[model samples]
Each structure stands twice: as structure tokens, then as C-alpha cells.
Target: MEYNEFITHVQTLTQSDSREEAERATLAILKTINELVPDEEMQEIAVQLPQKLGEILREKETKSNQSFNLQEFIERASQKENIKPTTTAIHARAVFSVLQSSITPDVFTKFHKYFSHDYEELFFTSP
Candidate 1:
């Protein structure tokens, strides 16, 4: 999706009040995800992302790399954005939903392999 479409979808999904809020949440979610997936895969995904979003992911390329499961992923994104884990989970699921639609299903599955099956709900909002 284009950047505008991306932001609009995020705002709709998150019920964000303003453009800034949506941008912050989207960038935070992307950056947090950048820290999780491997460098090579991140590069591949970045190519499919918008210019600014791609740059955000690339900026994390040389930063510290972290490996986290589903809960820790939500916790870290929450801490990074200074939000609650429950709230972060919602934002993250929105991001993942966008990614699932934007990226090839094969590559999206590859990214999820980084997490465990417990994250399935975060993927498709399963019960």
C-alpha cells in the first residue's frame, strides 16, 4: 500500500484520533518488528514497504538485535511506546494485519517463524 493508504488503514484499525498518533504507532510497531526479524529478511520486507517506513527499519539494522516471543514482543513495543501491553497488542495486531496484506504470504510466514504458535491470535485475531 502507499503511505497514505497505510496510515489511513492504521488509523482506522487503531481508532487513532490524529495523524500523528497513527504515524507514531505505525512507526513504533515497524521499528519494534525490525528488531525482531533477521537482517536479511528485514531488508527484503523493507523493500516492499514505503520509503519512510523502509528507512525506519534500515536505521535499526546496526542497532542491537533482540529475539523475543509473542508476549515479550508486545511488552517491548508497549515499553517503547510507553503504552500498556494490552493496548500495544492491539496496535501490533493491526500492524501485522497490514503486513499480512502487504507482504507475500510466504515471507510473512517466515517472519512469524520468529515467534511461536501462541502468537497465532496476534496474526489473525483468533479467539
Candidate 2:
């Protein structure tokens, strides 16, 4: 999807009042993923997304840090998105939902494999 369409979907899914809010939330999740997944794996997923989103995923240069769990993931994203921890999961679901729909199944699978079973909960929540 194009960047605008991607952001619009995020906004619609999260019911954010402004595109900017959705964009920030989306980037927060993407950036978190960038930090969690290895650079090569992240690059694989990034190329499949819109240019802007891809760039966001590639913004970080460090190696992946997979030590953290789901709660820490939520906390990091909440802080980055500037949203409450209570609502971060919903926003994160919106971001991942948009990602699942936008990319090829293969690419999504590659991205999904990086997260453990616990992270699967984010996928089921209402966006």
C-alpha cells in the first residue's frame, strides 16, 4: 500500500482523531520491531512495505535485541507513541493489522516468526 493509504488504515483501525497520531503510533510499532528483529530480517520485511514505512524499519543500525518480552514491547511502544500503556496494545494491533494486510503472506510470516507465541495476543485484539 501507499504511505497515505497505510496511514489511513492505521487511523481507521485505531480510530485516531488525526493522521499524525496514527502515523506516530504506526512508527512506534515499526521502530520497536526494527529494534527486535535482526537487521537482515527487518530488511526483508521493510522492502515489502511502503517506502516511508520501510525507511522507518531501517532507521536503526544496531543488531536485534530479543531479550525483552511482550509487556516490555508494549511499554516501549507506548512510550514512543506517547500513549498510555493501557491503550498501546490496541494501537499496536492497529499497526500490525495494517502490516498483515499490506504485505505478502510470506513476508508477514517472516516478520511474525520473530515474535514469540506471547506476542500473538497482539494480533487478535481489536484494532
Candidate 3:
């Protein structure tokens, strides 16, 4: 799927009243996306993924960090010609890509599926 579409998908899958549930769902999606894409592209995406995901996952804590504003960081990074805007899906794909590089593809696949399944459970179980 395209970047925007993927972000929308993640948003849908992650909708929850509880921030903890949303964060877990987002992390699951990120792990899956990381397993499915390529290395170079993953590295590019990684520049923004951790921060963006961190924001959604750690809303209050991240705010207090002073240096954890992913959106602002992305905006500044985008000012450079080489850096692309970090969309939700792009961040997911980047995470997968980085994982692919760091771990064996087989392990990544297993972990991705496991996380995806766990997120699905959380998404459904949430009130």
C-alpha cells in the first residue's frame, strides 16, 4: 500500500480510548511494516519512525522530553532536499526495514506476525 493509505490503516487499527492500547497497536504495525520493506528505504524512514511512534505511544512523556517532537523534527528534516516527510506508513515500513537489516529475515517474519496478532487482539479486546 501507499504511505498515506498505510497510515490510515494503522490509525483505524489503532483507534482506542486507552493510549496504552493505541501505542501497542502502533508498535505492532511498525514491526510488521519494518519486516516487509527494504534496507536503504528503511534507514531513510527510521530517521522519523522512532520519534513519530514515540509521540503517539508516549504522548505526555515525550512532550516533557524537550527533544522528542517527531512532527517538528520531521518538518525541519523536510526542509532539506534529501529528507522526505514522515508519514505513518512510511514510518512503519522504515521500522520493518531496519529490523530486516538488524535481524535475520526469518526471525523478523516470525516476530512481525506475532506482534501483528497481538495488536489485533488488543485492538479488539479494548472497550
Candidate 4:
């Protein structure tokens, strides 16, 4: 996915009217997610994304405060985006759904391993 495609798909997927909104949601999602997974795993995932987005994730991957779990991840994401937990899930699912199509299956598989099965519903947009 290229930069425009990645951002557009996320905006369309999340039904966001503003470009900044989509960007914020994506940044929060990626930043929060990178905090949960190992940097190596995120690097694998990032290489498959658009350069801009890959850089975004990579920048976040090196944070010292990366010990948060799924629930804390959501909380931080929600706070970043100024939304509720449920709304954060919507944003995260938008990005994850894009990631599903963009990254290798194995990378996404590794992503899920960092969390419980409860995250499946949040990380994948069901058909």
C-alpha cells in the first residue's frame, strides 16, 4: 500500500470525513500497537506498509515505555485520539484491516500472539 492508498483506505474504512482524523487514528493505532509488540515484529510488519506509515511505526517502535498490554493500548489510543474505547476499536480495526491486506499473513499472525483471543474481533474487520 502506498501512502495515499493507506490513508484513504483507513479513512474510507473508518468513515472519517476529515483527512486529519484518519491520520490521527492511524498514528494512534500504530503507536499503541508498536508498544505492545516487539520492535522486530513491528519492523517486519512495517516493511510491508507504505514508506510514510512504515516510518511512523518505526519511530514509535523505539519508545522506552512499551510495556503496555491490550487494554492499556486501547486506553492510550483512545486518549490520543480523544475518543472512547469503542471508537478506538473502530480506528484500530480500520488500520488493522488495511494491515491484513498489506502485510504478510505471518506478520499479522505474530501480531495476534501478543494479545489474547479477545483481540481478534478488534484486529480484523469481519466480512
Candidate 5:
């Protein structure tokens, strides 16, 4: 799903009348983000994401009809953290790593297709 859709889902899942539920939802989102990004990248990105996501949820709560500003969120996240803004590349690597570490060889062929040329280009271009 797109970030906007994912955020909407998260917001819905998180908005409980209770503070405890909200906290739990935040933790779940953080876990998902950690699982999705490289471990090294997580610390930097995590510093900014929870607050950003909370802002998004707050906006949705106050202005029920307003459309979510997903592009702005992405732009802000990348700029604030000095991280690459490509979700596909990040998620592809995360899923590939998870499959590699846990799944059997029979599933490798299915998971392998998710790997992207962007990562290869990134690897080659790095100093």
C-alpha cells in the first residue's frame, strides 16, 4: 500500500479512546518501521517518524475531512533525516532479508523477485 493508505490504516488502528491503546499502536508502528528499514537506518529514521506520524494522526482527528498530506510527510521525513526517500527500495531490502533469514529455500524464488536494481545501483555508487 502507499504511504498515505498505510498511514490511514495506522491511524485508524491507533486511535483508541484510551491512551494505552494509542501507545500500543505507536509501538506496533515502530516495530514495523524497524522491520522494514535496515538496522543502521532505523535509529536515524525512528528519531523523526513517530512524531511525524503522530502529527498526521492529530490532523486527521481535528480536521476529519482534510486529506492526508502524504507527499509532504515523505518530503519532511527525507529532509529531516538525510535519508533516501524511496519506500520500494527500503521495503524490498527488508522483505528480502527477512525471507533470507527465516524462510526455506523453496520460498526464495518467490521472494527474490522483490529485490530491485535500485539497491544494486546504490551499492555500486557508494564511495
Candidate 6:
């Protein structure tokens, strides 16, 4: 997807008030993923995304050991995006949904493998 289409999907999925909100959420999640996924894996995921969106993942380098769990992951994005922790999960799922749909399945499988099983919850909304 193009950057606008990706932002639109995120806004629609998260029910954001504007494009900026969706963009912020997208960056927050992408940066958070940058901290979690290894460099090689992240590079693979980045190449499949829109240039602008991929740049966020490429530009932000994290020295974190990536020892955090799912809850911590949400909290980090919430803090970075300057949104409520409760809402961060919603934004994260929206971003993940967009990522899954936009990228190749093989690359997505590789991306998904980096996160633990509990993190799978971020990929889908609660039923």
C-alpha cells in the first residue's frame, strides 16, 4: 500500500480523528517493532513497506535488548505516541493488520516469528 492508503487504513481501523493521529500511531508501532525485531528481520520488513513508512523503521536504531513482553510493548508505543495505554493496543493491532495485508506472506511469517506467542494478540482484535 502507498503511504496515504496505509494511513487511511490505520485511521479507519483505529477510528482516529485525523491522518496525523494514524501516522503517529504507525510510527510508534514501527519504532517499537524496530526495538524488538533484529536488524536483518527488520530490514526485510522495511523493504516491503512504503518508502516513507519504511524509513521510520530504518532510521530509528534501538540499543534495547528487546526483553519486554506484550504489555510492555503496548506501554512503550503508548508512551511514544503520547496516547493512553488502553488505546495503544488498538492502534498496534491496526498497524499490524495493515502490515500483514501489505507485505508478502513469506516476509510476514518471518516477521511474526520474532515475536512470542502472546504478542500474536496484537495482530487481531479481541472477539
Best by TM-score: 6
- TM-score of model 5 (CA atoms): 0.28
Most lDDT-accurate candidate? 6
Q: After superposition, how far is residue 58 of candidate 6 from its true place, in Å?
A: 0.9
Stretches off by above 4 angstroms in model 3 are: 1-14, 50-127
Q: Could you report the Cα RMSD, in angstroms, for every candidate shown?
A: 2.3, 2.4, 14.0, 2.3, 15.4, 2.1
Descending-TM-score candidate ranking: 6, 2, 1, 4, 3, 5
Which residue pairs does candidate 1 place in steric collision? none
Ranking by lDDT: 6, 2, 4, 1, 3, 5
| C-alpha TM-scores of all predictions | 0.87, 0.91, 0.31, 0.86, 0.28, 0.92
Off by over 4 Å in 1: 61-65, 125-127
The alpha-carbon lDDT assigned to residue 48 of candidate 3 equals: 41
Q: Write the per-residue lDDT of candidate 4 for residues 43-98, one digit (tens) a residue.
A: 89888898888887788534533565667778989988998998888888898888
Pull out the clashing pairs in model 2. none
Q: Residues 1-127, candidate 3, lDDT per residue (tens digit)?
A: 3334334444444343444433444455443333333443344444443455423323221122223233443343334213345444343433344434444555444443434232331222215
| Residue pair clashes in candidate 4 | none
Please give the TM-score that candidate 3 achieves against the real structure. Answer: 0.31
User: Candidate 4: worst 10 consecutive residues by lDDT?
Assistant: 60-69
Task: Indicate whether candidate 2 or candidate 3 has the larger lDDT.
Answer: 2
Q: In model 2, what is the error at residue 93, expressed in angstroms?
A: 0.2
> How displaced is residue 86 in candidate 2, in Å?
1.5
